[model samples]
Structure formats: C-alpha cells, structure tokens
Target: MFRSIITGSGAYIPTEIQSNPDFFTQPFYSNGLLLPSSSHDIVSKFKQITGIEQRRYVSQDLTAGDIGAIAARNAISDSGINPEEIDQLIVAHNFGNVAAGAIQSKAVPSLASSIKHQLGIRNPACVAYDVLFGCPGWLQGIIQADAFFKAGIANKALVIGTETLSRVSDRYDRDSMIFSDGAGAVVLEYKDTVSTDRGILSASVQTHALEENGYISMGSSDFPDSDPQVQYIKMKGRKVYEYALLNVPAAMKDCLDKSGVPIQNLKKIFIHQANEKMDEAIVQRFYQLYDLPAPVDIMPMSIHWLGNSSVATIPTLIDLVKQGQMPEHKLEEGDVILLASVGAGMNINAVCYRY
Candidate 1:
C-alpha cells in the first residue's frame, strides 16, 4: 500500500493582531439594539471563554488567496522542492478571491495559477483545484493527495487551507467572536519506498446530521435574499458544541483503531482548534467515557490565538511544529500522531500519521 508523506509545511498569519478592543470599537455593531459592550468587557469575556490572547486578521484589501499563496510558496521552499516539480495544487477554502458567479467558476484554479506565475513555475503538468468542506476540507485534501500519489497519478502535490472568515463574519453577532483569518499549506511527495521517518498511517471520515441548520451560512445564492445580514455567518453555538463534543473523540478512536494502534500509544493529539472549553470538555469526557488514560499530549489551542481558521488549524499546527514552538512531545520514529476535526455539514474526520 502506498502511504502519503508530509514533506513540508508552512503557515501565514497576518501581522495585524486584532484585540477585543478593536472589535468593540468598530461601527459595524452600532445599529444593533444591544449596545456594543466596552472593550475591557469584551476582552475579559473572550479571554475567560476561549483562552486566546489575540488573533491575526488580514488588512482591508487582502484576500484569502493572497494568504494561501504565501503559505504555499513557503511550504514548497521548505520541502526543498522546486515549484516546477509540483504536479498538483489543491486548495481547501470556504472563501476565495472571486464571488461565486452564475456559471460554475471556482477561484482555486485562478489562485493556483497566480501562485505558479509568481513563483515562475511554468510546468505543463501543473493542475489546480479547490475543495469546500468547511473545517474538514484540509483533512479531505490530505486523503485525496494520498490517494493520488498512491495511484501514481501525481508525484508531488500541495494542499492548502486558507480562510478569510472575517469576510463572512457577522460583526454584530457574539458567535463571531471565535473566528479569525489565516492560511496554512503542506507539501506532499510520493516515494516508492516507505521509511519509518515520516508519513500518514491511516485515515477515516464520517458525517452525521448534515441537515442545513441556520447555524451554518450557505452562500447568498442558496437564500436569494438582498438583505446583507443573511449573507453573514450565523450559528446555533450550543447545538454545534453538542455535536463537536460528542463526535470528535469518537472519530479519533475510530482512526486509531483502523490504524491498529491504541489511543494511549499516540505521541501527540491535534484536534480542531474550535473552542477552548469544548476542547477541555472533550478531553475530560474521553477519559471518563472510554476508561482510557487522559490525553496528556495536546497541541496548543489555536482558536484563542489564531481563531478558527476553518480548515487551516492542523496545517498551522504543523508550521508551529517546524518552528520549534511546540516542543517535541516524544514523537519518535514509529510513534503515532492523531489529527481530528469537525466542521459544518456536521462532518467529522480523523487521521493517524506515524513519524
């Protein structure tokens, strides 16, 4: 069996860190009946709730594609691979540069072309495409790239997850408090001989309760309303929390079982950095529900600092790993790492990688 290996990873966070004070001062919430709270109140509430100090957001003119391109270039460079060697580029994003038009136009290809042009990668084999699956998009992209490499259809591929969630965020809604903007990318390469050094071990994905609740915002075309408010993201926070807390740990166990490994054997655990409280709750419950040892190896909760960058969370974690910010938690050869996430569409995914 051909296994997928992650060669290099990179992440781009905008330099502009937006504090809660910045959010409260904006005039976007002025018209709402509930007066905007003071900056101190907002900051204290957010810090207590999410455990995040600050988050990065793009400047007014930058798009998701711009952040994605930067991350992609850095990933390619980090892998010691020339851009021309890339055979495919897969971008997982909920927001892109262009508005979805009437006739099936996706912005991924264009974004890929722009990246290729800027990097001077003029290879004829280059192909670019986009996948939209909310937070699980990057996990799906990893599985897709692995399958393609296994089939010998592509020698090298780049998978990226970028989201300018602020663009779709309802500034007036407190639910928006948990979202921020960023991008992350990883380079995958095919190798005939599998080594114990690095690569994916197993992956599994499942969906439950995919009904389109008002919680997840579909594009404007789905609703066909001129009201700008409807276009912004809205969610039933408690409902989503219920789904996440229940589903994520189960998915993690499933992936570990499929890989013939025990959850206790994992060297590190990377869950979607959605909510800090949810994260803590899941950890506590997983121990109680399964009679397993508590997960001691945990990655930093990025949502508080990075906000929910949708699918970018794991890849950004990868960047942090490479940067030595996350101390090596005994991830040795043959040791396993688990990645899990849940997103809109009520999707849940889990994958195990052996390093």
Candidate 2:
C-alpha cells in the first residue's frame, strides 16, 4: 500500500526572547477600562493559567515567509532531497507577512509563492500554495498532502507552518502574552510500505463555525483610544477553553478509533500549544473515554517557553523532539503518536501517525 511518511522536519525559533517581566511596564486594558490588578499580579496569574513564562519574537527585519523558507530549506536538507524534486510546497499561515509595527498583512503573491521564490525552486511542476486553516493549518496541509499522494497527483511534498503572532497581538490585551513567533516544516514522501503501521494512518477534522467561530477573532485594541480601524488578535478565553475541552478530546478519540491504534499504545500526543491547562484537560478527557487515566509524559509541551505560535506549534515541537532538544521526550522506531490542534475558526483536528 502507498503511504505518506514524514522523512525530515525542521524548525526556526526566533532569537528575541520576551520574558514575563518585560510586560510589567506596559499597561493593559479590558472593556476600555484599565485592569484593576497590578501588572505583577496580572502576570503571575497569567503564568499560573497559561504556563507561559516567555516567548520568542522575530527581529524587526524578519517576515513569516523568510522564517518559513529557512525552515523549509532545513527540512529539505534533512531529507537529502533536491528542492527541484519536491512535488508540492504548502505554506500554512494566517497573517501573511505582517511587519513589526504594522497591522496590514502583505500576501499578494501568497506566502507559499514567496517561500518558493526565496528557495529558488525552478520546477513549475512543484506547485506551491498557501492554506489558512487557523492553528490546525500545518496538520491540514499534511492531510491534503496525504490525499494528493493517494490520488497519485504528487509523491513528495513539503509542508510548512509559520506565524508571527507577536506582530498581530494587541499590546493592551493581557492575552497577548500567549502569542509568539516561529516556523516549522516537514518533508513527506510517498512510499510503498509492506505494512500500514509506519505512516499517517487516519485523521479527524471538524469546524464549528456557527457559534464557535467568534471565539477567537480580531478586533480593535482594548485600549479605548487606539484606532478602531486597525485590528488585532482577540479571544474569548473562557469560551475557547470550554469549547476545546468539550470537542478536541472527542475528535482525538475518533481519529484514534479510526486508526485502530489501541489506547494503551499511544506514545506521545503533540497537541497545539495554545493553552497549558486547556491542552491538559483535553488529553485527560481523551483518555477517560477509554476508562483510563492519561499517562505521564504522553504529551510533550513547549508552551512554557515557546508560547503559542499558532500553526507552528506542533511541527516545531516535533522538530525539537526529533533533534533531541527535549531530553525527556523522544520518538523511537515503531512508536505510535498523535498530533492534534484547536484554534480560530473553532477548527479542531487530530492525526494518527507512527514513527
């Protein structure tokens, strides 16, 4: 049987580190009113809830496409495949190329095209495109690549998720602390595997746009005097938490069931690094469905330091673990793992994969 397998992965982490104390001097607002709590208390509570002590932000000169291409180059080099041989190049991003201090996103040629040009990929048959599926964008790209491989339209693909959430975040919103910047890429190749236990097995994706679409949205800054014409990332934190807690676990369970992977065999879960508590709860509930408690170290988290880089989280986590950066979490041959995510559009998805 033909299967799509990830051959190489890479990630680009920003150099600038913005720690929790960096926001102490910055004022925060809610409902056009200054927060009653002091910055110290607010930051402390924020860390308690989200588990983010610091996050990376790109230097002023960098753009999402730039970082994405760096990651893609690394992935290609890791795969030991010539760039001209790649069949498809998929770039997953939200705010295309938001400048350091700008609210506008420059995506005229599409981020994928931009990355393609930057990489000097001369093959026209290597079609490149962009996807905007919220935080699940990278995984969604993987799903699409799998479809293309099965359909015989492509045999090799490169998927990248890049975001500069720090550029789109509202400085006056406390939730801004959850935003970061990073890029990740993976090279996938179609192979004829004698067994079905070594590649992507199954996936489940859902979009609840009716009532949950507005949970994570864009709006004017919380500071009353800021220009209303400009928009920034905003979220109904409680609503998102509740929605994800209720739905993500079920989606994961469905994917696992379809893959026929026994519950006890799930070695690692690389979930989106949106919120620490929310992810923990979702995984715990996922295990509960099988009448078992969630296993320790089943989930390797980078949120405490990386924060939420939107679509870049899962792939970046994979690259880190693959590179042996995370000593406590490592993938071995024949290990079964799941990749899951939830984000704006109220989209949720899970992929069952074997290493």
Candidate 3:
C-alpha cells in the first residue's frame, strides 16, 4: 500500500509586526465611529485575553498569492525537487489573492493556479486546485494529498495555506486584533511501505453549517451606499468561543480514537491558533475525556507571537517546530503528532500522524 510522508515544510511571515501596544498608539474606529477607550487598558486586556504579543502583516506592496508562492518555492526547495516533478498543487485560502490594503478580494483563476504559474511548472497533467474549509483548509489539503497518494493518482503534491486576512479585517472591530497575513506549505510524497504504523493514521472533518451562520462572515451586502466597511471579516466572538470550546475537544478526541492513537501518545497537538484561552480550554477538555491531566507542553502554540493566520496557523506552527525555531517543541523519528482546526463554516477537523 502507498503511504504519504511529508518531505518538507516552509512558511513565509510578513516583515511588519502589529503589537498590542500599537493599537494604543492609533485611533480605533468601529461602525464608522471612533472607539472610546484608553490604549493602555485596551492593550492590557488584549494581552490578557488573547495572549498575543504581536502578529505579522503584509506591507502595502504584497498580495496573498505573493507570499503563498514564496512559501511554495521554499517548500519545493527544501524537498530538493524540480517544479516539474510536482503532480499537484493545492492552496487553501479564504479571500483569495487580495492586495495588502484592499477591502475586497478577487478570486479569478484561483490562488492555486497563480501559484503554479508563479513556480513556472510546465506539466499540464499536474492538477492545481483550492480548498475552502475555513481554518482547517491546510489540514484538509494535506488530507486530500494523502487520498490522491493512496489512490495511485499522484506521487508528489504540494499543500499550502496562505491568507492576507488583514486585507479583509475590519479594523473597527475587535476581531481585527486577532488577524494577520502569512502562508505555510508542505510537500507530500507517496512512499512504498509495508509499515502500517507510520504516516497519516486518520483524519476527521465535520461542518456545522446551521450553527455557523452569522458566527463568521465575509464581504458586504449589495445595497448601494452600504458602508464600504461592510465588506470585511466579521465574527460573533463570544458565540465562536463557546461553540469551539464545546465541540472542538470532542472532534479531536474522536479523531485520535479513529486513528488508533491514544491521546497520551501525542508528542504535540498543533491546533488552529485562533485564541489562547479557547485553545487551552479545548486541549484541557481533550485530556479530561481520557481521564488524564493536560500536560504542560502537549500543545505547542505560536499564536502568542504570531496571532491568528486562519488556515496558515497549524502548518506554520509545524514548520517552525520542525526547524527548531520553536525550541520548546521538537520532533524525533517515530514521533506522533495531532493537527486540528476550527473556523468559519463552523468547521472542525483533526489529522493524526506519526513522523
């Protein structure tokens, strides 16, 4: 049987960093109205609640596809493979390719096509497509690559999650503080192996569309003179938090069970870096389900410094840990890892694997 193994990983974070204190230095507008709050208090509260010290944002010169291509190139380079050798390219993104400061995004041709073009791949048989599963898009892309590998349809695939969420963020809203711009990528290759104990063990994905309406939305209405500001990322923060806390743990536990991976065997649980507190609560509850206390380092998080990059979160975190950029998190041969995410479709997914 064919099993998929990650051959390489890469990430691209914009140079500009937005810190909590920066909010205090600038005026915040909400619903076209200036917010009335002290900067120090706001910063303190933001740090306390979100635990984000800062996040990176693309400068006025970059587009979503630019960073994504850069990440793809890096992963390809790391894999030491020629661009023409790739059998497929999959990009996961929300707003497509938007300029740094643009309010509206354009999706024509798809970011996957743009990335393939940017890489100068000449193979017409090499398929390219985009996945839109919210923050779980990257993980879902990985899952799709594995499916293709197992089906004898592809030998090598590149999966990427890239977003310029800052372009779609409403600075007037509090959720604005949680978003940034970035991309992450991985190269997966089919490996002939008799070992059933390695590679992707299982993946579980579910969507709760009924509960997601209004929980998270993008773009504005068609009415004339509708505040142009309406075309920005919006979220019912409290509802999302509660929904995630209630559902994500169960989804993760079920994924681990399906993968035949005991919860305690995980070397690290890489989850969507949406919220520090919410992620903690979810992990804690995951342990509670198994009647075990949560380990201090079971979950490796980059959100405290990187903010939430949606689909880019888990892949980027994995790249950083594997590269030793995240010193506290390390992966050895035969190590087990769990990747999971939740976001806009009210979607939740988990992937279990051994590396």
Candidate 4:
C-alpha cells in the first residue's frame, strides 16, 4: 500500500499585529460594548483567560486566496517539485477570499483553484478543491489527500489551510480580539516505506450535526446601523469551551487508540489555535485518558504569539516547527505527531502520522 509522506510545508502570517489594548482603544459606535469589566482590567483578564497576546491582519490589498497562494508557492518550492507534478490541491478554510479591507467573504471559485492558477499549474488532470470542515478543514484536506494516494489517484498533493477572520470578525465584539489572518500549506508525496509505523498511520473526523445552532456562527451582527444584515462571526464562548473540553480530548484518545500510538510515544501534538486554556485542558485530559501525566512540552502552541487563525492554526504551527522556528518541539524520521482541531459546525477531527 502506498503511504503519504509530508515532504514540504510553508506558512504565511499577515504583518499587522493587534494586541488586546489595541481592541480596547478602537472607537466604538455602540453603547453596550462587550467590555462589562473595568477597562484597566480587561486586558489582564483576557490574558489570564485566553492566553492570546496578539494577532495579525492583512493589509488592504491581500486576500485569503492571495496569502494561501503565497504559502502554496513556498510549499511547492520547498518540496523541490514542479507545480505540474502536484496531483491534487485541497484548501481548508472558514471564509473564502476576503479582500484586505473588505468586510465580506466570498468563495465564488475555490481557493485551491485560485492557488493552482497562481502557481501557474497547467495540468487539467490535477484535482483541486476546498474543504470546509471548520478548523478541522486542513487536517481533513490532508486526510483526503492520503486517501488519494492510497487509491492510486495521485502521487503527490498540496494541502493548505487559510483564513482571514479579520474580515468576518465583529470589531466591537470581544471575540474579534481572538481572530487573525494567515495561511499554511504542505506537500505530500506517495512513498513506499518499509516501516508500517511511519507516515500517516490513522485518522478520524467527527461532526456534531446539531452544533451549528449555538456553538459558533458567522453571519449578520445585531448592532443597529451596521451594514444592513452584514454578517460577522459570533460564538457562544461558554458553550464552545465546554463542548471542546468535553469532546475534543475524547476524539484525540480515540484516534490515538485506533492508531495504536501510545500516549508516551507521541512526540508532539498540534491542536487548533483556538484558545490556550481550552487546548491546555484538552491536552491534559488527553494524557489522562492514557493514565499519564500531561507533559508541558508535548504540545507546542502559537496561540499566544499568533492568536487563532482557525484552520490555518495547525498547518502554520507544523510549518513553523518543521522550519526550526519552534525549538521547543522537533520532528525526526521516527517521531509521531498528532494533528487535531475542533471548531464551527461542531466539527472535530484528528490525524496520527509518523514523521
């Protein structure tokens, strides 16, 4: 059986950084600002709770697809493969392409298709599409790519996760402080490995179908005089936090158990950069599921420095670690890495791979 091996990866984070203070200082048009606490205590409380320091936003010219294309180009370049050699393109994203200054998002044509054109790929046979599995989209894309490899449909594939949450975020809303813009891409090639333990070992995805109602949503904000029914991202934070803590670790344990990768064997686990507290709790519970103490270094997070970029979180973190940007964790040929995410549509997914 052919195995999918990740050959190269790349990431793109916007240059604009906005800290918590930046949000508090922004002009508010509405009276009932979400900040019910003292202005002085808001930042400190936010830090104590979420652990996000700042996030990046794109300038007025770039779009989600633009950043995704840049990351894709870098990934292909890193892979040392010609663009035409990529047999598949899968982009996992929340919002499609939202221009740098635009307030709306659009996915008229798939970002994968856009990146294909940007990379100057002329092969009509190269399959290109997008996956919208919430924050799990990118990992889902990778999983689908692996299937193509196992089915003898593609020798190599480019998978990407990109998002421009800044466009869809409600500036006055507290959740806006957590959203960011970024993209990440990886190149996977078909390989025949002698070790059955290496490469993609196993993967699984789960969707809580009824979750769309209250957990998280993106659409019109209720503020008056806002863009008439202008859509923006919203969330029931307590609900999401509770649901994540309850379901995500269980899913991780399930994937690890199915993959036969013991908790002690996992070198690093890259979960979605949604919330620091939530992720930390989930990781702790994950180790408990194996009757092991949670190791601090087992999970490396970019949420403090990068904020939450939705689906972009996992791939970007993976690319950063692979590029030696994250010295806290490293992947070797025999090391096992766990990729997981939980987000909108009440979606959760995990993948086990030996690097």
Candidate 5:
C-alpha cells in the first residue's frame, strides 16, 4: 500500500510582537458603541478567556504570500528533496494575500502559484492551487494531497497554511486581541510501504453551514463613525465557542475510531490554537467519549504566546514542536498523534498519524 508521510515541516512566526498592554490605550467598541469598560478590564477578560498575552504581527512590508513562501522554502529545504520533484503544491489561507495596511485581498494569481514562483521551482508538471477551508484549510490540503497520492497522480506534495489576520482585524473590536499572523508548511511524499502503521492513517471532516455560516463573517468596523464600506473580520464569539465545543470533540473521536487506535496509545493532539479554554474543553469531552480522563500534557498549546492565526495555527504548532523549539512537547519515533481544527464554515477535521 502507498501511504502519505510528512517528511519536513516549517513555520514563520511574524517578527513584530503585540502584547496585551499594547492595547491599553486603544478604544474598543461593540455594535457601533464605544465600550464603557476600561481597556484594562477588557484586556484582562480577554487574556483570561483566550489565554493570549501576546501575538505576532507581520511587518508592515510583508504580505501573507511572502511569509507563506518563506515557510515553504524552509520546508522544501528541510525535506532535502529537489523542488522540481514536487508534483503538487497547495496553499491554505483565509483572506488571501492581504497587503499590509490594506483592507482588500488579492487572489488572482493564486497564493500557491505566487509561492511556487518565489520558491523558483521550474517544473511545469508541478501543479499549484489554493484551499480556503477556513482555519481547517491546511489540514484539508493535506487530506487532498493524501487522496492524490492514493490515486497515483502525485508522489510528492507541499502543503502550507498561512494567514495575516491582523491585516483584516478591526482594531476597535475586542476580538482583535485574538488575531495574529503566521505561516506553516509541510512536505509529504507517498511511500510504497509494507506497513500501514506509519504515515497518515485515517481522517474525518465536517462542515455545519446552515445557521453556522455567519458565525465568522466580515462586517464593517464596530466603531461608530467608521467607514461602512470597509469590511473587517467579525466573529460571534459565543456562537463559535458553543459550536466548536459541541462538534469538534465528536469529529475527533470519529477520526480516532476510524484509525483503529486505542485511546491509551494516542500520544498527542495538535489542535487548532483558537481559544485556550475552548480547546481544553473540547479535548476533555473527547476523552470522555472514550470513558477515560484526558491525559496530562496530551495536548501541546501555543496560543499563550502565538494568539489565533486562523489557518496557520495547527501546521505552525506542529512545526514548532517538531523542531524541538517547544521544550515541554516533543514528537519521537513510534509516537501516535492527532491533528484537529475548527473554524469559519464551522468546519471541523482531524487526522490520525503514526510517527
């Protein structure tokens, strides 16, 4: 059987840091009304709920595609494979290449094509495309690459998730504190192996779009007197929390079951860095589905310092831990892990893999 195996990973965390204290002087608003609460109180509540003390922002000179290409270059180098050998290149993003200080995003060239050009790969056989599946987009790209491998159409693929949420965030909205910018990439190759235990094993994905479609939509700034023509990322915080808490756990359990792996053998979970509390709650419920207590440190978290970078979260987290930059978390041979994410589209997906 042929299996898709991840051979290399890389992440580009923005260089500019925005700490919570940085927002103390900025006025926040809700429903076109200035919030009466002091900035200190609002920031305190935000930190408590999201556990984000700081987040990275792209430099004023960079765009999403630039950073995505940086991460992709690193991943290709890490894989030690010639770029010409790659049969597919997929880039996952939410807002496309939103230039710094701009509200509009451009997708005409396709972020994947841009990144491929930046990487200087000359093979015309290398197909490049983009996937916009909300924050689960990167995983969706990986899933798609795995399908291509199974169909014998592709042997090597490069998958990336990159986003510049800060570029589209409404500074007047308190949810702005939850946004960040980053890029992550991974190289996957199909191997004809006698054993199915290694590489990607099973996966599950779900999207609840009926009433959930508007949970994370774009709207004019919440600040009164702001231009209504300009749109910024708007989210129904409570609705998203409730929806993710309700559905993500079940989807994760379903994927794990499909992998035929026991709960006791699951080593780690690299879940999307959305909200710290919501992620913990979802993991707890997932364990409960197996009638077991959620194990200590079973999940490695980066939201405390990275904030939520939408599509970039999971892949970045995996790259960080894989590179040994995260001291408390590590991935060793024979380790079994699950990658899961939920976001706009109310999309949910999970992948079971053996290292």
Candidate 6:
C-alpha cells in the first residue's frame, strides 16, 4: 500500500482584526434602516453568546482566491519541492468571490492559472479542480489527494481551503460575528514506507444533507418582481449544536477503529475549532463513551480568538504546530493523532495519522 505524507503546510490571515466591541459600536444601518434602541443590548448578548473575541477580514478588493494563492505559494516554498513536481491542485471552498455558478465557469480556472504563472510551473500533466463541501472541504480534499497519490497518478498535490465569509455575512445579524476570512494550504507527497516516518493511516467522512438543521440564507424578495441576493449564511444554532455533539465523537471512533488504534493511545486530537462550548461538550462526551480519561493533552483551541475560518481550521492547527504554540507531547514513531471535523451541511469527517 502507498503512503501519503504531508510534506508542508501554510496559512494566511489578513492583518485586520475586528473585535466584537468594534463591530457592535460601529454605526451601520441594515436594509437602509437604523437599529432600534435595543441595539446595545443585542450587541452585548451576542458577544456573550458566541464567545468570539475577534476575527480577520481581507480588504474589500481581495478575493478568496487571492488569499488561497498566497497560502499555496508559501506551502510550495516550504515543502522544498519545485512547483513542477505538483501534479494536481485542489481548491476547497465554501464561498467564492463571484457567484456560486460563476465559480464553476471562471473562478477556479483563473486561480489555477495565476498560481501556475506565479510559480513558473509548466506541467501539462497537472490537473486543477475545485470542491465544495461546506466546512469539511479541506478534509475531503486531503482524502482526494491520498487516493491520487496511492494510485501513482500524482507525485505531489496542493490542497487549499479558503473562505471570505465576510462578503456573505449579514451585517445586522449577530450570527455573522462568528465567521471570518482566511485561507490555508497543505502539500501532500507520495512517499515510500522506507523514506517516511509519518503518513495517513485511515479516513472516514459522512454527510447528512437531507436534514434541514443548518443551511445558508436565501435572500428575501420584497417586491413582486425583483432579483434577490441569495448569498448570506443562515443557521439554526440549537439544531447544529445537537447534531455536532452526537455525530463528531462517533466519527472519531470510526477512524480509530479503522486504524486499529485505541482512543487512549492517541497523543493528540485536533478537532474542528467550531466553538469553545461545543468543543468542551464533545470532549466530555468522548471521554464518557470511550471509558478513558479525557484527552487533556489536546491543544487549547484557537477558534474563540480566530472565529470560525471554515475549512482553514485544520491547516491553521498545523500552522500553530509549526509556530511551536501546540504543546509538545511524547508522540512515539508509530503513535497516532486524530483529526476530526464537523461542519455546515451537517458534515462530519475524521482521519488517523501516525507520527
């Protein structure tokens, strides 16, 4: 069997950080109407509810592809691999700068061309594609890269997840505060077992799309004949909470089972940084279900401060590891670490990696 190894990883966030106080204090009208006298109270309540200290958004001129391209370039440079070695590029995104339909026609191809031009890569054998899987897009991209590598169809692949959620945010809705803009990328390479010490062991992904628990917002039509802007994000917080609490732990268990590693033996567990409260609840339930001590060795979450960066969360964790913020655990050569994520579209994914 072939081993797919992560050769390099990178992430990029805009320099601007918008704290809750700044957001709420700004004088902004929604739908051409001023907020009522209750605006202050609503802002305070929202801040307490989401627990998001701040989030980053790119300048108005920047697009999701721009941020993703920057991160991809960094990952390629860091991997010490020439761009010509990359046989494929996969961009996993939830929101594109253009209309969703426009992306299928133009956006991804433009991004691929720009990256290839900037890197001076001239590989006619390379293929580029885009994927949309809500928040679990990056994980799904990794699984795709693994398959291509195992088939000997590719020697290297670049997988990127980038989102400019701010563009689709409902300015008046408090829920928009939980999302931000960012991009992250990973370079995957095929490696012989004799040459690599770390590689993917197993992966599992599932989606519950028929359920209407959480979904994007379709704009309202006020007049009899008007084009509605169906671009904003809408969600049912309570229902999403319940679904995540139940499904994420089960997904982790499945990955562990497939990899033949006991839950207690995992040195680290990097879950999707959805929210602090949800993270705590999932950790507690996992301990109860597995009959082991809670995995206290897990990294302190970066989501509360960063907000939800959609698919960038996992590569952001990998970036944290590179920055030395992730705690050092005694991970042996063959020990396993679990990466699990639950996202919008009610998707859940888990993967096992040996380090």
lDDT of 4: 0.85
Against the true structure, whose lDDT is highest?
A: 2
Clashing pairs in 4: 219-231, 219-232, 220-231
CA lDDT scores, all candidates in order: 0.74, 0.94, 0.86, 0.85, 0.94, 0.74
Candidate 2 matches the true fold with a TM-score of 0.99
Instruction: List candidate 3 stretches off by more than 4 Å.
Output: 29-36, 219-230
Error of 1 at 67 (Å): 1.1
Q: Candidate 4 lDDT, tens digit per residue, 1-355? A: 5578888999998999888777556533333444456544666676788899889988878888999999998888888998888899999998899875666567878888988888889999888999988888899999899998888889989999998888888776666778889999999999887765468888888889774455888655545456756778888888999898889999988888888877788899999999899999999988888788888788889999899999899999999999999887787889988899999889899999988
Tell me the tens digit of each residue's lDDT in model 3 across 1-355.
5578888899998899998878876555555555678656766787888889999999888888889999898898888887798998999999898875555578888999999999999899889999998889999899899888877899999999999988887665666889988999999888765664567888888889995766998745333345766587788888999999889999998889998867767888999999899899999998899999899998898998899999888879988998899898889978888888999898899988888
Per-residue lDDT of model 6, residues 87-161, tens digit only: 988888876654322312236454555555656778877787777778888888888889888887887999888
Per-candidate TM-score against the hidden true structure: 0.86, 0.99, 0.94, 0.95, 0.99, 0.87
Query: Which residue runs of candidate 4 sit more than 4 Å off their true CA positions?
Result: 27-34, 195-197, 211-213, 222-224
lDDT of 1 by residue, 309-336 (tens): 8888889977887667667543455767
Clashes of each: 0, 0, 0, 3, 0, 0
Query: What is the Cα-based TM-score of model 5?
Result: 0.99
Rate residue 19 of model 3 by lDDT.
84
- Candidate 5 lDDT over 115-225, as tens digits, reads 999999999999999999999999999999999999989999999999999989999999999999999999999997565457998999999999999999999999899
Backbone clashes in candidate 2 total 0
**Candidate 4: Cα lDDT at 174:** 64
Ranking by lDDT: 2, 5, 3, 4, 6, 1
